[model samples]
Structure formats: C-alpha cells, structure tokens
Target: MKKYYLRAAFIIAVGLFISGCAGKSDLSLNIINGEKLEENQLLTTKNSIYLVNGGDGMKTTYLSVVYGEEIAEGSGLAAVNIANEQLCAYTAPVVLEKLVITEKEALENAKLNQSDYVIYSRVEKWTDPLGINCTVGYYTDEASVVLSLYSTKDEKLLNTTRLSKSSCPFKINNIPVSTGSAEILYEELFANWKNNMFAKVSK
Candidate 1:
C-alpha cells in the first residue's frame, strides 16, 4: 500500500512538472518604439557613413534564459551583416565601409577619411516562429535593431533610430519537404527596413 501511494505521488509530480513547462511562454522579440527618417534628416551623398557592429546582447549563455536558443547563438550578427549589405545597395554616392577595427580605431579612420557620419547598429532581439499551416511552413521571423548616427565633424550624436521588422509568412512547398531558413526571413525584413529608412533620400 505504501509503494502504491509513492508511485501515485511520483506520477502527480511528473504531471505538475510537465504542466509548468508547457505553461511557460517562450522568449520572443518585441518592438518598443520605431520611427521613420525625414528628408531633412537623411544622410547625403557627400557624407561618408561608417558601419559598426555593436553585436547583440547574447555573447554569454546566461542571456539565453531571457533570449532563448535562437538569439544566444549570435544570429543577430547575421542580421547586422544583412542590414549593412542592404544599406550599401540602396545608398548611392555615399562612402560606406564596415568597421573591422575597434571603435576608437574606426573613429580615427573616419576622421582621417573626412567622414561626415558614422552609423553604429546593433541587433536587440530576434525570434523565429517555425509554424506550419496546411501546405506551407512559415518562418515568421521578427527582429529589432538600434541605429545611432553620429556626426563625425562635431563628434556628437545626430540621431538614434530603433528599427523593427516582422517577416511575412514564407511559403514552403516542395517534394523534398523543405522549410525556409532564418536568412531568408531576415533578408526580407532588413530589406524592407532599409527601403523605409532611405525612402526620403531618393526624393
């Protein structure tokens, strides 16, 4: 009788554990604030822009508790790279280079090159919901990035913009049963963000 009671208690404990785990919400990215750049606020072709990768807040495992596995693996860096590429494609007649050196070194380089502006960007959050709806699997990816623009001439912060984007459902239908990758979703999101940022530039 005692053994039977103990077994029942164990089963109840297991059930409770499972329930707790299931009830917990997975960590996801949320945009706090976002703004669009005005024509007067846009960077001009005469200005040079320096790209700096501030890196996401996930170089350590402890952050994983709040950021989850997807963000802790440095996927944010990939998003930064994508944003840099998109910026280069859209912004014409402007000098842009990815900063490979330290912040101080980059600043020195910018001054030497007579750069008008230095843009520093960092990924804040990234989330991918690999969901399925009948015939298609969707990578509903979301991301937030903070962009800071500094005037190299005055060495003062000109503006700070937080950009966030959520990708539409990417259709996946094939004989090989393939789902979309995170890269595809991030590409779409960053491209949209880049276009929106420089919308007034071309005008």
Candidate 2:
C-alpha cells in the first residue's frame, strides 16, 4: 500500500511538471501599411528622427516565460539603439533621439521636438527551441521585427520595413541545462537585423 501511494504521488508530480514546461505564450502586434523607403533615401542630419518602442509580437512555446520578457524589453530596444547608432555613423550624420513615450504621446513629442520622422518598431516574432533529447540537443533562436517610419508633420505613414534573422543550430551536450541560450540568440538576431538594416539604408 505504501509503495503504491508513493508511485501515484510521483506520477502526479511528473504530470504537473510536464504541464508547466508545456506552457506557451503569445504576443500580438499592431501592423500598418506604408511606403517602403529606398536605400538611397536614408535619413540625413537635416531630418530629425524620433524612435519609439512599438512592443513585441511573439508566439513561442519553449522558454516562453523567459523569452517573452526579453521580447518585451530586449529585442525592440536593441534594434532601435542599433539603428540610431548606424544613423549617426552615416556619411551625412543623422541625429536620432530616443523618445520614451506611449503611442498617444508620440505625436505630441514629435511636434514639440519638430521631428521630421518618427520611427516605431516592434518585435514580430521570437522563438527559442530546446530539443527533447537530454544528452545531445539541437537549439535554434529566431527574432523578427517590423519598422515603420512616419511623418510627424502630418502624422502620415511614410515607409515600413521588416527584418528577421535566426541563429545557426546550436548543439548542446546537456539538454536539461540552460546555457544562456536565450541571451545569445537575441544578441545574434538583433545584431544581424541591425547590420542588415544598415546595409539597406546606408550609402
């Protein structure tokens, strides 16, 4: 009787653990349509730009809790910062300012700063895959972002761009142990996105 009770308790605990690990999360995005900016039309010093966080749209199953928070704060902000740095490094040297404001406050801040353009970006997708095999596992991280440039003068949509990248397969000898996979994945994804964006915009 005692042995049977212990076995039942163990099964229940295993079931609960599996259920928790199987949890998933979803992130929705607000998308808008607009013209696409050409590579030669990158911003210049004369054009003042304001950047705002547009949130993240992620649908992930593996490591959702850990990756979701990162998408909320890490991916979107990283892309904007990288873009700003690249803009400053342009031949004409564009000045980009960070505007920590909500969507409602965006237009008002743009008006006050006389910003020619307001750029809003959101993380469209984020995924972290942890393989099932405990000894040798394959992992992959992917991130995608949608960038929109708006005319602050008229509050009209100007241009929109979407960028996405994924890291190569990561082979992990220990599947049960987290090797800071989420951090490494986002870093690589954001860096690749930034470089690709710069290549498209920079002269």
In candidate 1 the C-alpha lDDT for residue 173 amounts to 38
TM-score of each: 0.54, 0.52
| Cα deviation of 57, candidate 1, in Å | 4.5
Candidate 2 per-residue lDDT, tens place, 14-93, comes to 87775555422222222346543466644455566677777655545545446543333455565566666655554333
**Clash pairs detected, candidate 2:** none
How good is model 1 by TM-score? 0.54
**What residue pairs clash in candidate 1, if any at all?**
none
Worst 10 residues of 2 by lDDT: 22-31
**Per-residue C-alpha lDDT of model 1 across residues 110-142, encoded as one tens digit per residue:** 688777677666666565444332122123344
Per-model C-alpha RMSD? 13.4, 13.2
